[model samples]
Target: MPGRGAGRVLCVSEFVRNVRLWFAPQEIREEGGTPDYRFSLANERTFLAWLRTALALIGGGFAVDQFLPDLRWAWRAGLALALLAAGVLCALRAVNHWVRTERAMRRGEDLPVSRFPALLSLVVAVVAVAMVVVVLTGWEG
Candidate 1:
């Protein structure tokens, strides 16, 4: 029997256990770590959601970046940049939200509801509406 493999397996198992334990603080607060874990997972999900939205925006930008036949390449490129910028901004916000939520959880304080993300969402909504208007009226010129 090749028992050397067992030693490697044990080492791997120990490493994973150590890392998982280290993932969260071990101070053993009254609230435990579940809430923190929840907030962390929520943050991760939010990031994924933002990534999906970014993909949609980039795809739309490419699809409609140059609707008119005579539109300049610079115009299309600028739209692409705007879409990418929106994605980057969204990512930054998701990280910021996670950090604040995690900090609150650590301090055993009431988690604060954030308005910044809601405001950003509204901004995106308005931009979407404006984009529709521009696309619809693009042929007028």
Candidate 2:
């Protein structure tokens, strides 16, 4: 029992450390002075917006899978999976961008550049096109 609990305790401690690092890694936090509150708030807002988009995409995936039972299995699964995958990617991008932007602002560097927006847009467009094709072709169960 002690041995089993020891591993569990170690795992929990590692998880806590990882969570703390995710939010406030020392390398980034200590590298420069604190940024203005306004900029920090803006960065947080942008991060929240990305999270909202991710949530919406995830919800849309669930809706497609649940509300469109008449859709062919392959199409429904594909659409749902695509939306879910996009949501996951968006969530990850949100964190990475937030960290990079925050670090840049703190260091008085130009904000980091990224192609995530363009890539996300392209993904959405492709999904939309697929949806239109499915609807037009009457691909239903």
> Per-residue alpha-carbon lDDT of model 1 for 1-141, expressed as tens digits?
469999989867844543443345453243335464776677668767866776776666666564534444555566556766776766655555555555567676787576666776786787677666655665464
* Candidate 2 residue spans exceeding 4 A from truth: 1-24
Name the runs in model 1 displaced over 4 angstroms.
1-39, 66-75
The RMSD of every model to the true structure, in order and in angstroms, is 13.5, 8.6
Q: What residue pairs clash in candidate 2, if any at all?
A: none
Error of 1 at 88 (Å): 1.0
Q: What's the lDDT for all of these models? A: 0.61, 0.86
**Per-residue C-alpha lDDT of model 2 across residues 1-141, encoded as one tens digit per residue:** 999999999967854654565767776678689999999999999999999999999998998899877788888899999999999999977887787788789899999888889999999999989888877674533
Q: Measured by TM-score, how close is model 1 to the native structure?
A: 0.55
